[model samples]
Target: MVLVSAVRDYISRMLQDISGMKVLILDSHTVSIVSVAYSQSELLQKEVFLVELVDSISKSRESMSHLKAVYFLAPTSENIQYLRRHLVAPRFGEYHLFFSNILKDTQIHILADSDEHEVVQQLQEFYADFVASDPYHFTLNMPSNHIYMLPAVVDHSNLQRFSDRVVDGIAAVFLALKRRPVIRYQRTSDIAKRIAQETAVSTVVYSK
Candidate 1:
């Protein structure tokens, strides 16, 4: 399936299922995922008035009991922690949680414990972890993606852990902002040469 359409459809289905004013919550990655396929105006049409980051939402204690909270977050520990905090306090009238990928049993248990108010109406998994830039283009949306080019395997491993992400059947994209390394350094590293090769491969493949 085309990445853009798949993600867009998933989001549309998620919003349409519930009726009322909604506060759309997202994580760092899902921000790119939704923003790429959906616009601010589009969300407004779907009754989404507020778009907040999981990390940032913890700062405010204001109650929004009038709005329904529709959380579209990645299944990560940090994001889960933020959700837990929100659940305990019970700001919104109702909570509809949707994860971008599979949620672990432990994660669910943690949420179950935090939801003392019983505000969470539904929980679901909609697997669209990567951002869909266009019908033909998509990305992992990793900010520190350049770490993949480090000489040691540990650097790549750490970045993977930070993002709680993995990749397969993919290349070149593992190394984003390819030109950064070339322009930043006067001398080419081993990985720098590999970047050139990937660029050549991409050009050749697209030309066909």
Candidate 2:
């Protein structure tokens, strides 16, 4: 239950410090990360009254200052844009931003710049990027499935992007466990080697 426990612990840490009724906001990717490990009843027990996607949350104009917003999303540009728009005209009284993986300094600056109202209570990287499907396995649910079959030289940028995501997911799992692992990959697959190397680099970056 390593992956499940890690995700559950991360969620618990995010919610436990913030008291009172809260609305849990998640992006499309994070929704899968959370749903597999946590249940509605469990969230209700933790005082989470609402669960909405970041994009969908902006559609509602009604204000609910009574509830705090707990956002768990990926550090993607689209997600950042949605947050910027939400921060411009916030409906909730307080916002607690938590990225599922490491966030860049520029992304932090974007969020800080957008929060003119001073509604953000905290910003943190929780590193639950993968969906913990079972005790022994997890998935990134990467969209570029076809890229894995193609040679790395065919489309270097897309291949790099794909490798980076795989690395991030691996890094997140290790970060959750608080351990540095010696990565190994199948020698037959170039993609696996690339992912492993990138994961090693990520591990080094996170270690520092």
TM-score for candidate 2: 0.93
- CA lDDT, candidate 1, residue 124: 88
TM-score of every candidate relative to the true structure: 0.75, 0.93
Give one digit per residue, the lDDT tens place, for model 2 in 1-208: 9889999999999999999999999998999999998999999999999999999988898999999999999999899999999999999999999999988899999999999999999999987999999988988897757757665556678777777888899998888888888988888888888888888888878978
Top-lDDT candidate index:
2
Candidate 1's error at 81, in angstroms?
Answer: 0.8
| Candidate whose TM-score is highest | 2
lDDT tens per residue, model 1, 1-208: 4666777888998899889999998888788889988999999999999999888888989899999999998888998899898998988999999987667899999999999999999998765777766776777766766766666645555744633353311222223212222223225566555445544554344233
- Residue 131 of model 2 has an lDDT of 94
Tell me the whole-model lDDT of each prediction, alpha carbons only.
0.74, 0.90
Query: For candidate 1, which ten residues in a row score worst on lDDT?
Result: 168-177
lDDT value, residue 88 of candidate 2: 97
Candidate 1 lDDT (Cα, whole model)? 0.74
For model 1, the stretches where C-alpha displacement exceeds 4 angstroms are 144-151, 155-164, 168-208
